[model samples]
Target: MSDKKDPSVWQGFKAFLMRGNVVDLAVAVVVGAAFTNIVNAVVKGMISPVIGAIGTKNLDHYDSCLSATCQGDQGIQIMWGSVLGATLQFLITAAVVYFLMVLPMAKFLARQEARKKAREGTEAAVELTELEVLKEIRDELVARRRSEYGER
Candidate 1:
């Protein structure tokens, strides 16, 4: 009984990993990490300076002082400006991927699938022609008339 314990759970897990969707997800994760570096570079290199020029010296550095703290204990915080920049970068990356990659790929695949179905339907329809249908109707009518005359 122990030896005969179901292997289905392990088999299902193996099947899940082998599926194209799972493989594609794994690939996307790796590619997304690489793309994140590029997006971060673009945001930090270009957008940060522009924002900094318009505002404070550093976009990523913000400080808040607590109420009546001792001189030595004065709150000097370095709120993550770079993290904010990174967040923006991630948003842009997501938008680009959705519009440029996902949307176009989905549309292309849908069109291809539709075309394949249409071709298959056309091939199936080719077996029945208008002329053949008209001939079948004529033959049926002739047989009916002969049967009527024979009955008389």
Candidate 2:
């Protein structure tokens, strides 16, 4: 067969782009980037000082001399204190999100889903009992038989 591009490929791509999940993912990416700045600010503004009070706030200060001529100005430097501060900030932000946002949202969504399922179950139960459906089928067959025989 001769090679020919399918027009439906573009249509499918367009449909995929328009889907709700893709749109939601795009929004989440933007929002998450914005939220990261806020978290970083909170860490720098609020958490760093409290850590400073503990006198271990700057983890990057720990250094070991690597050379015989290790004068204070010529020695190798390690920046572990800054790293420690960043790690602590990450942990704090994660804890806040877990407790303040994720946990409550998860619980609320679970309850909402449960209530929806219960409503659907109630509606399904009210719609038809097995005996009622069987009766309906039996009546249909009886009417069909009577019609075939031209009975009253």
Candidate 3:
């Protein structure tokens, strides 16, 4: 009975895509993807070399074969070294992101929030002072009016 037409599905989809959180999540995904390479490079270049100095050059090579012979996964073989390498890589990535990005961002946000609260407090004080001044002026005007009228 209404003249208005219902919105199209594509319009709704477009609205969802254009939302702030969706855009932020997309940006985060892209930045995370780009940052992954840097973490990987650090692990491969710096951490790997340090580990290599103490042990084998390649961490992947430090595995144990459950079977008598490890012929290309033909027998049961536990690749604990690969697991260790992966774990190390994850730890390095987490540490780099935590120290470089997360910690700094958290500190910055806290400082910003503190500044915002301080500003709000000052604004409230100023507003209260202005209200008090206005009330005093109103009281003075009323008193002068009453005195002049009482004389008549």
Clashes of 1: 1
The superposed Cα distance between candidate 1 and the true structure at residue 46, in angstroms, equals 1.8
lDDT of each: 0.79, 0.79, 0.89
Higher-lDDT candidate among 1 and 3? 3
Lowest summed lDDT over 10 consecutive residues: which window, candidate 3?
A: 1-10
lDDT of 2 at 96: 79
TM-score of 3: 0.77
Ranking by lDDT: 3, 2, 1
Off by over 4 Å in 2: 1-16, 56-59, 62-76, 127-152
lDDT of 1 by residue, 35-130 (tens): 888877877787777887877646555444455552455655545665676678778888878998999999999999999999988876875675
Q: Estimate the lDDT of model 1.
A: 0.79
Which scores better on lDDT, 2 or 3? 3
Cα lDDT tens digits, model 2, 1-152, are: 12344557767888999999999999989987887898888877777668778764454654556667667688665656776777876897788789988999999999999999999988888776866898999999999999989965
For residues 47-117, write the lDDT of model 3, one tens digit per residue. 88998999985788888888888898588878888899899888887998899999999999999999999
Error of 1 at 133 (Å): 2.0
All-Cα superposition RMSD per candidate: 4.5, 6.2, 4.0
